[model samples]
Target: MATEFEMKEIKSGDPEAARHSSMAAPQKSVTVKFENLNYSVSIKAKKTVTEKVILNNVSGMFKPGKFTAIMGNSGSGKTSLLNAGAVKGGKISGDLIINGEKMDTKFMKKMSAFVMQDDVILGTMTVREAITMSALLRLPPEIPKSEKLDRVDEIISMLRLDKAQNTVIGSTRVKGVSGGERKRTGNLIIFKIPAMAMEMVTNPSIILLDEPTSGLDSFTAYSVCTTLSDLAEQGRTVVATIHQPSSDIFLIFDDLLLLSEGRVAYYGPSSAVIDYFTKIDYPFPDYVNPADFIFMHILNNSEEAKQADKKKDALNKVLLEWDNSENKKVMLNTPATQKGLPADVMKVNASFYEQFRFLLTRAGKNVWRNALMVRARLGQAVFLGILLGLVYRDVSSRPLKSQTQALGIFLASVFEDVQVALFLAPMLIMPMMVFSGFLINNNNIPVYFNWIKYLSPIKYGFTAAAKNEFQGLVMTDQFGSLTGEKVLDDLAFTDELPVDQNLYVLLSMFIILIGMAYMALWRATKKVV
Candidate 1:
């Protein structure tokens, strides 16, 4: 019987294996190497500030065609190491090399895919729609839409998600796909290792996952591990910070970097870890799971101060042993030299306009499918419109009292629409509307509170509505009657601005608010390293 590695080797040599490869884009080899990496964060207590070291002198290499698992106890800096290595923004000091060359943050962001633990997916979209939209946005603009869609289908089939391809990804408030499928949707490459191996639409050289098997059952965890292993076998460099994995799952990793309190306890092939510990006179008992034993041995002794000190000494011995080991000397001591990388791999294919158009189309589809949210918004708009129409019926030809009522209703409607669309909270809307000139006379407002009217959307709405309504109308007020101009003067709406000018101001505010909302959504849904 052939081992898993032997089977992978056989598959690589088989000509038929190419048939299963992705046809969407060509795959490129990526090697990620980090040396003497250290990360720290500053914390302030009262007037004094202190820097907390998160990752201390961490170093490792992730090569193409291999899966590296970083395991550690809670607060062991596994995540810190992963983040530092991704070239993301932080207080990190290290030498990070990609494909034997020092790459910039922009290159890393463009060429790599980082899948965080929490699944960030649009609940309104179906499995196919989400993946298809991602392909459209991430793939090079030169790739045809048809070809990009073919890649989506290939990824769906490769990940064994064909059954749920059209199923909606439901959220807590909505009903949709399963947790496993949701996780798969978050990382397209690992979800469909075969398709990624053949040719992914994005064609990322390196992939990083933070706790890919977290919140999964034994069987599901095993399946996820198998998929990651398959991704590594296809010549992609895969690195993941895993939680407590089962014994069977642990064996699937090609390399292991065990960390304890931001320090390396062991770093080498997974098969050699047990032997390394045994050589230090710490051997696993008969029939004991090596992964469980390793963690237990490292952390089990850290309960009391004396035991913790002893455990620290033991851990240091292992770290020192690894430092002197032949594997470490060969893998870590050699400095990486610059190598030419593929132009396509480093280039971002899509233009800003293309990304915006694709995002807009996807957002429109999401809104369309989210029937409950759509109905709610439409219902509010229609209800408010009808209510305003009834309250201010025929005010264009009515007396001053009716016209004033009409102005109030119109102002309220505008403010309400803007509030509902932008803030999405009545708590915030009510206060802003109260301070607006419609409900309270601007002259009577306190000096400090007078600034609120200028910043309030309701003030702009009321001003615009009043100007449009009373511009040239005749009114019947206390002095037997007055022109709309006189009424505007009495109400202190004497800005001398034209109706079109006020409308333009309102339109500008609306555009600004919409832009802010878009930025918020982008930040919330964006990938985190």
Candidate 2:
């Protein structure tokens, strides 16, 4: 199994230390297994909170040297289960035993690369740069830099991305790598922006992807799956959530985990699924594609439900059949144990200067390359500034504008607080929903909590929006012309701060939030060295 990317270590001529380091010194094989994993989230609506169950009693194992696909119709908790295995955290309860130890976000982040479905790698860098920079940042520093770059080159070759090495992970706006090449980087691309797609270049032994093949051609999707298969060959635990793959793409996955209504309907080898379904009384026709047949005939909760409603009883029966079958026993009976490499492989090794230099360079490039961002932001400022200028320019006239100012840095710092923002970002932003003004009147809130309105950027932004929409103008009706001032007074916006004050608040908050974000990142990088 030794290749250009791997090397033999000779440490004091000691066999035990070499065994502990495993393959070499940086990357080691990982086995991730979980059982009784139940995940749910509390969703708040108009006036009530409800728990939405995503994964129920889901038990599965993604072993090293296996390309596993978790497939189900929309809302089958495929993404949920993958995130669980990634240990990104949710209202999840289970034993996620990695290398025979129950790990946390810190350790998992060290040993795994999670490519979310959206907002993947930075779109500005070239394919080689993305992978190379990721290696420089995440690989153990004890290894020489040249060897790290060599490993990156090996990965690029494995992914067949060497031909597209210089290509920019482009977006719909910027010309860059092809869709297939982007997906092949072993990362997720949202079809609009090109992703760095070099999640594999890190020391992370485990890789979790959500729809890496989404938005690609059938051949490209198959090719991406094949790249994952190659990673399995390299002894990495590869797990991804795929949707409605073609027969060829389906054939590429060594194992399959099918879910329906937050429950495990099937979990086993991809080739065995047809036999399993056939044995459960749902016969597969000779010419029909098993995937399509399973979706329409077996899973009543699938997006493509036809007579699936009538098949609800039948779906329950199928679930029961799988639950009671020996396949479930085999899946649960797989030994949950393994040998782990040294702890150095489970930590990011980079100097603060290195991280800052890379980040600043990336940001500078992003700003320089993306002229539209600057131009659009300038256009918005000009328009909003002119709008307020045309108004009486009263200190009490306009109000809160949230998204344009400090929200990103504020939310980023908050997300960094928890260290895992996969699902936590939205969860952290839940307070915004309550404070958004339109959802609840500021007056109705209790006096002790009423001061929070001062902190709610939505209040100020909505006031400005309301003022811009209704102030200084008149509405004409069949009865008479009503002054916009009357409408503003009626909405109680007259009591709020004016355009000038709102700008000051947002500007100050933006400045402060930026400082906070900088400190948060600085402290984080301060430890890496």
Candidate 3:
């Protein structure tokens, strides 16, 4: 019986594999490289703000299948380099080669995934639900539903996140998924690279994380880096921008690309970086981390260093030359760095309809499972209705004096009820639902939607309440008594069933309120949170 790894090897072999068992199989490697990369953001001020360069003449290459860390001082171009790959906005100039092909920004976006420093996961989605929607919407336009599920399961297994797969990303109100799970969820969605799941994750070509360990505990950070190191060994290109990493975490990096004020101060294997720094006249003191030492050197900016234009120019030139060298390009060699998913994994006929169904399915499951704080919302709406009903149950016998007074009370009560309905409906429910839907779908609504008023539960509730109270009330009697008997005809008691109508109206309003609440929430959360 063949082992799983052996099976994978046999199945992954090319068509010629069956014909020549003794033939030497050609080795695969990542041909990813970069040249003359530059990114600069504009500082627009009311009165021409001074220009500050973020990334200056930055050029570097990332070897495939290596755990590479881009480190620098606060303003160092570490993140800017990652951003220059895609989505990050700025004037950019450079050649990025992936798989021996010059990478355009658009193509790079498809080939790479960029993770930001902040957590962008929505609150209403469960861990599994979030990853599933991502797989549906992001996977190349050709993969099938069955394959997408398989891929999601693969990612869950790869990240060791199966434990929290079903947990909602709850907020402060309730305990929810852990930060690591949330981060992994974001990664699975943003980066649609399928081969990443089966491969060990050290240096990943498909995944580029910005400050992966920032703000995490030491143990967690080290664990993340350890997993990343494993990925690198599997021949994936994993590039990350890290700041002030712990010593234990620091040990995990295979390579370090250190920058100071947009200049490459060090670019080599992590073990050699400290000795290289010492040779360059910037020795690390005892107990001082090499990462921190490099950062401090760039941020020092002493009067002598600042004033010596010649030294600065020379440093800049060395940095530029080192960055443009050919050895850096050779470092990216990894077996699976350029090996994409098999044709079976990458589909061409994946349609918007199918993707939509997956999104819809994931969203529906989340709603049905009540995994999205829905119970709390449903409970809140019911509680609000009961509370408001009990608070303002009977306003039928209130005085109505002048026409102005009647208008005031009527407007106050109806509008107040409308406001309450609108407030609770959109407020309690909108953020989570809006968060859920818009989190995946890019659909937009007009700013001034007249139809929205028709859809408002507050409008329905307010109107229903008004109809019950004043559908047949004597407008004149409600005010002061009129001087003529003709007014009495209008005020005279009629055969109308006011009490029953009030009861029906109240019930209708209550039902409509419930329906509207559900509808708004339903539309909002009908996607990954």
Candidate 2 lDDT over residue span 1-529, tens digit each: 1111111121112223112111222366777778888998779899999988899888888888788888888888988787676655457788877777776667776677777655455677788888888788766677789988887877776666778999888876677888677766645433222222455656457778888878888766666667666666667788888888876666667788889988889988877777777766777776565677778778855434475565777888887887788888887778744665446655547888888898888888887777688789789779756754544333332223222222332332333333223433764455554564555665566778677667755566666666665667665645657666775675567878886786677678668877988898777644321
lDDT score of residue 112 within candidate 3: 53
C-alpha TM-scores of all predictions? 0.82, 0.66, 0.59
The digit string of per-residue lDDT tens for model 1 on 79-133 reads 7776777655358887788877785777776667677676557788888877776
Better of 1 and 3 by TM-score: 1
Q: Where is the poorest 10-residue window by lDDT in model 2?
A: 1-10
| Index of the highest-TM-score prediction | 1
Off by over 4 Å in 1: 1-27, 42-50, 187-200, 301-309, 323-326, 334-338, 393-407, 410-456, 476-479, 512-529
**What residue runs in model 2 are displaced by over 4 Å at the alpha carbon?**
1-26, 186-196, 302-309, 340-342, 373-513, 519-529
- Candidate 1 differs from the real structure by a C-alpha RMSD in angstroms, to one decimal, of 5.3
By lDDT, the best candidate is: 1
Alpha-carbon RMSD, each predicted model: 5.3, 13.3, 12.4
Candidate that beats the other on lDDT, 1 or 2, i.e. the better one: 1
Task: Give the clashing residue pairs of candidate 1, or none.
Answer: 21-198, 22-198, 22-199
